[model samples]
Target chain A: MLIWRKTMEMIPGGTLITATPEEGRQLAMTMARKSIGAIQPEAEVRKALPPKYANSPDSLTAAAQVVALEFATIAAANKYWRKNS
Target chain B: MLIWRKTMEMIPGGTLITATPEEGRQLAMTMARKSIGAIQPEAEVRKALPPKYANSPDSLTAAAQVVALEFATIAAANKYWRKNS
Candidate 1:
């Protein structure tokens, strides 16, 4: 991941990758796959920001599904972590 | 990616990752996320193999959606790659 980060530093909007760990990996891998020697300038990162941070009884439930796929993958790969998600 | 492959070598079913590039990344990142120092020897890789290779006009259409998310993410990040899936 570090190499991916460093490799992306050659591009213009590269620093934007530090937004979040998940976002960073997504940016890094995308760049690496394209073999783009430098970060593509003007790249945009669109996100549906926190949705006003629920602050309701359902907040926890909402957050749980955010990374459902990641959790599922982890659970599937490690028996100790397996559970019905 | 290479580092991921090497790190996974210590895990029992680790070599199973090389089955496919997409599967390998999924395996490596999943392993790295869990910090499972040694590969989970009994880990299983479940997959819904190609459904008898469509061998029909719709075959191409079926494949177009398999990596829809990846292409969407790539397009969302790079204007040059942008396209409606």
Candidate 2:
């Protein structure tokens, strides 16, 4: 969470979004249409885990991977937006 | 700095304040006057160190201390703000 926030701050005017994975997919689609894709879905990643497994080490590792993927995807989107917008 | 953002998010509408130590001291004093004391001085902490020493491990360690102290101070102020605000 801390690293995610730091990474978010590096980008300007980044509004953090928290949503379910379904909502995330939807929002990502919407942002894609507008060429604005910098959503940080840490909330969805955590929510998708079972309650009993939420704070387990495996869950934490999985969450890290989710965040990393989001960062890369968002970075690519921003690069595209920069070139086109 | 990342820890600071997560800590700030724990509180609502906390726009991070990045300022010089002198400015920080003044702002802390002003916030103190308003009975708002949750100002993180990591910027000031980093600036106060010599430029050559900025990226050294010691500087990083020092910055971490400043952030920790700020967290403790802000948490206390928030406790007070919660009680009084």
Candidate 3:
């Protein structure tokens, strides 16, 4: 249940992570490269995952799917707040 | 470069669309089911895509990656505005 913001993904038993649009993009690109400290290896995260995630065929792909929802949730909420756009 | 509410993914050359948080969730879940009219067949959209998308390993996977930024942007922007999250 750890959350830095409403747009964060709970990293199973590890950390709840939040990122800007820019940082998220960078994370997706460099996740396999180890270019950033915030991004963890798929294997490392996978090892400690709850049963729900440990069973996925690809953790990175599953993570991307889960993370995308947070992004869309923010996008939709703002659209409601702004009213016109 | 087609966009909707600064929180939408460009559907190659189709329409600019926006949705609520709930609607986005529905779109993601029933995307393969044809449960809603707005969700299109992946193959149909694939046919109309630009050269960049026509070459992807999986357009749906690629799309989830792109759409996430808009969600994160809205999430981050609101966080900046709220200042206490």
- TM-score for chain B in model 3: 0.30
Sort every candidate by lDDT, greatest first.
Answer: 3, 2, 1
Candidates in descending DockQ order: 3, 1, 2
| Winner by TM-score | 3
For each candidate, report its DockQ versus the true two-chain complex. Answer: 0.03, 0.02, 0.04
Model 1's alpha-carbon lDDT is: 0.29
What is chain B's TM-score across the candidates, in the order shown? 0.26, 0.32, 0.30
The sequence of per-residue lDDT tens digits that candidate 2 reaches over residues B1-85 is: 3322223333333532422222222232233322222334355654565544322223223333233234224333333122221
Residue A85, candidate 2: Cα error in Å is: 52
lDDT of 1 at B57: 16
Candidate 2 lDDT for residue A32 = 29
Of 1 and 2, which scores higher on TM-score? 2
Tens digit per residue, CA lDDT, model 2, A1-85: 0111122222222321323344334433332211111122244543553566445676455434334433333333233234333
Models ranked on TM-score: 3, 2, 1
> DockQ of candidate 3?
0.04
- For model 1, how does the per-residue alpha-carbon lDDT over B1-85 read when each residue is reduced to its tens digit? 1122235343336343233333333333333323322322223321233423322212222222222223223323333211210
What's the CA RMSD for each of the models?
18.3, 17.3, 14.4
- For candidate 1, write residues A1-85 as lDDT tens digits: 1011113122234222233345434543443333221111212211232344345445444333323423233222233222422
